[model samples]
Target: MKNKKPKKVFMNGAIPPEKIANSIANHQSKTSIGAHSIFLGQIRADEIEGKTVQAIGYSAYEEMAEKVFHEIREAAFSKFDMTCAHIYHSLGTVKTGEICLFVFTSSAHRKIAIEACNWLVEEIKAKVPVFGKEILEDETHQWKVNK
Candidate 1:
């Protein structure tokens, strides 16, 4: 059955490593899940035009983003034979080398888990209202474009 409760998808800042670890640990008891797929998005210190990116300040239309997230989850459940899925994204500043997004999907088999995780990432990139401002080392910023 699909989880009817709305998930809290946005975090205040960078996602902590411990949180990710705990998530994985929490699923150990679900013996029915044979495989799991995870995707982690980290901020990179990219040098653009002699400016080095130091961090990314994320923002979004929360209500709209939440609604879209729900739609994506529903679609995934309908399309794949997944056991469960979870998505968490940063809302504020996330420094270089820090995690900004975490996507986890599980299923009875490997293929379904992998496919669902990939599809969720793509759908989020294509549809979510989240925006990021790339902050350079000099404190200058530019709007980020997901590639």
Candidate 2:
């Protein structure tokens, strides 16, 4: 069996659109891949009570999160014929409309790409011990939980 190396899945802040574009551009040369599915999780400017959320200050138990991410990656590869996969999650403040999570999966067919993308996202949300502090416009904050 070939040894699979772990990938770096954490970014310091909000994910840039340029990074997503570059990732797509980088895969153009891999002719075997026919489909790509991308999932971007954006911070919402949600109103709670009377305050509007302006940003989310994210933090994580880095080591454990990375391990879970790697496990999810491996599971996706085993369950699907994926050509490549990348998972990135924010580690700090991500403002409203900015991306906090990015999951990119490519495969020879659309089904594999799409399924793997969704699976990785659900797994990450359910398993990762990442915390978020929702920063309201009033400068107050509240803990964010995935729903």
Candidate 3:
């Protein structure tokens, strides 16, 4: 957990799994929690209606994304006995099979942490103003949206 409130946002650019993993492992300690549930997101190359996705470009409204994320974190904390929460999302271009989002929630017990992790992801996806552009193998592109 943070010894002090994070002065700046955790991540607002390309997300590195190692950095996120290390941060989670470092942030939550024995005295702070008993369990940590992590959700790692990876980009996938897939064919959609005969078009293969080659890459994705992620963009976010920083102010809005940050505000929504903070609210989601606070809500999770109030609804569950979570110790802490960390969220990371990619910015700029991300190629196929690369992660665009990572969320980890810690608690004193397994069940709460698991549920919080799930909830946090959905909340971020629904509430954040993050846009994605799917670049096809043929170099064509389309925008991605929640279905």
Q: Considering only N, C-alpha and C atoms within 3 Å, which residue pairs clash in candidate 3?
A: 1-27, 43-98
TM-score of each: 0.98, 0.97, 0.87
RMSD of each: 0.8, 1.2, 2.7
Model 2, span 67-86: residue lDDT tens: 88888889888888899999
Q: What is the lDDT of residue 18 in candidate 3?
A: 78
TM-score of 1: 0.98
Better of 1 and 3 by TM-score: 1
In model 3, which regions exceed 4 Å deviation?
A: 1-14
Predicted structure with the largest lDDT when compared to the true one: 1
**Candidate 3 vs. true structure, TM-score:** 0.87
Residue pairs clashing in model 1 are none
**2 or 3, greater by TM-score:** 2
lDDT of each: 0.96, 0.93, 0.78
Q: Give one digit per residue, the lDDT tens place, for model 3 in 63-140.
A: 777777777777787788888778778888888877778888888888999999999988887887888898898988
Best-to-worst order by TM-score is 1, 2, 3
